[model samples]
Target: MSLQDLHGLLSNLQRNPGIPLDLDWVDSIRVNRSAAERRAATLPARRTVKKKYQAAWLLRAIACMDLTTLGGDDTPGTVRRLCAKARRPVRQEVLAALGAEQLGVRVGAVCVYHQMVPTAVEALQGSGIPVAAVAAGFPHGLSPFAQRLDEIRSSVAAGATEIDIVITRAHVLTGDWRALYDEIAAFREACGEAHLKTILATGELGTLTNVGKASAVAMMAGADFIKTSTGKETENATLPVGLVMARQIREYLDRTGYKVGYKPAGGIRTAKQSLDWLILMKEELGNEWLLPDLFRLGASSLLTDIERQLEHHATGRYAATHHQPMP
Candidate 1:
């Protein structure tokens, strides 16, 4: 019985915040050191591309946004609320700039704070891209449950099909796993048909073990995807953190036959970085995990750089940054 205290654990995790979560007893579950090493060894090879350096599939893969304001000013000077849009507005610019050139097979998802959802939503209209918003108390999950639920509602209302939220660090650190779990589960319920990406804010967790624990807890807590950080956190997504999360996701799926999603957000601002993380997921979870439903990369300034690299390869000359700075 590896953590079969469903009734008891569920009681501790949360109530009818109208969310769905899982009873996670992963810590009590053992780790297979041999299996871990085996996975690590095989991951690097999958990262290598079969084709030459091309830049055609990256654009459609990127969900680019900064979360300026869910329903705030689409105007400049509102730095936190502007999302480089009032300044850059390159979400579509990059798409058009890429023109017919296919972006590499990397880019994933874009993220923004709760307040910025609508702006990102509006900017990305007709671009055939999914809009993600940092709903609930994102940078900090201090707001009340109702408030957080409303925040999710607002983002969805603003046209966000994907909702990214944060687990309250205070609760998780205090051994209050149940509270964090319940909160995440409830958020999922509030999300309705929308996709939910929950941020563990790993830098704040302070250990790979804690990161592993949080990742498992979030998946069980009904998170459609478990993410690394908010980008505002002290430690954003790193290789080791990604490794730990991937390992947990692998183990969970191995046990339950249900494959959850993993997202490596923050500090992913380049093509190589994005590709490396994708390698981590693919190697750990297999080719089926390569799609957007299972994995995503949340970056702000990466799409165009990949484009420049691709264009240089395509045209035999360096591409200008002005071509399109975002995807």
Candidate 2:
């Protein structure tokens, strides 16, 4: 086999493990971009509206998404409860229902800890909903690179399509841009065929300027997505950080012509807040940015509120009796 064939084979073996390598792994990873785009073409605006701004985004909240919180105060039982209360599985059927028009489930993907990749992988096997896993000693990047690398490999072994990694704050804070770049580049390599989302822990990054600079560096070092925070810091996912990161993404896209996705997670538990992020996307990136391809809200509690809003929209009044509030 030629060099390209070898590279492709190894990449696939690295991405899709368990089965012995026989066919071209690269071929398995190859996607028909045109076909995917054609199939995934956003539905045309079936319902027209005259309003300049709308809270229609509340219809798409991924409620009770149990992001693995390995940090203090977050437990496995908590995750189980959240998933139980969600009344949904990580199966592709569930993701299909979410993206389908019937119930119009709007969750982008189920976010989980590195250990739960198997659950999501099994649940979403052959499903479009990507299994997203947190890495780089998520909640904090204090762990060594070896640990982070192991996390990435394990998640990939468990079939995570996307890896969310935390950036080394000390390096970035100390103006060690090269170190930061290298750190992210390592993750990019470990990701192989999967998408990489680098988190800046924006709340701890101190300023909007740093957030913007960090976004640029992360994107430059090959981040397919630059997430705002890990939702475990003193504060997670603030508008200022979102605004800063979005502005930088717009700027970077303008300069490089590469559209990098953005995710703002944490504290976005209300429909109003979620819509506010959508509004930010609309104002900054225009109407085309409204899709989940380029934007996502990393939220755990926003769903019930979104559902409530959807109910309110469908009915004349919001019903508090039928809905049970989540912790």
Best by TM-score: 1
lDDT of 2 at 219: 78
Q: Looking at model 2, which ten-residue stretch has the lowest summed lDDT? A: 1-10
Which lDDT values do the candidates have, in the order given? 0.62, 0.62
Candidate 1 — which residues are off by over 4 angstroms? 1-24, 29-47, 50-110
TM-score of 2: 0.73
Q: Write the per-residue lDDT of candidate 1 for residues 1-327, one digit (tens) a residue.
A: 111111112113222122234444654644454555565555555555532423433432342222223223334234323334422233444334545323322223335555655656665554444567787887777888799999999888877777889888887677677887778788888887677888899889866667777788788777777889877876798877777788777877776666677777677777666666667766667865555557676665665566666565455677678875432
Model 1 residue 296 lDDT score: 73
Query: lDDT by residue for model 2 over 170-271, one digit each (tens)?
Result: 876776767887788888889877778889988887655567667777877888788987887788876556666777778767766777778888787776
Q: In model 1, where is the ten-residue run with the lowest total lDDT? A: 1-10
TM-scores for candidates 1 onward, in order: 0.74, 0.73
Clashing pairs in 2: 98-105
Error of 1 at 18 (Å): 13
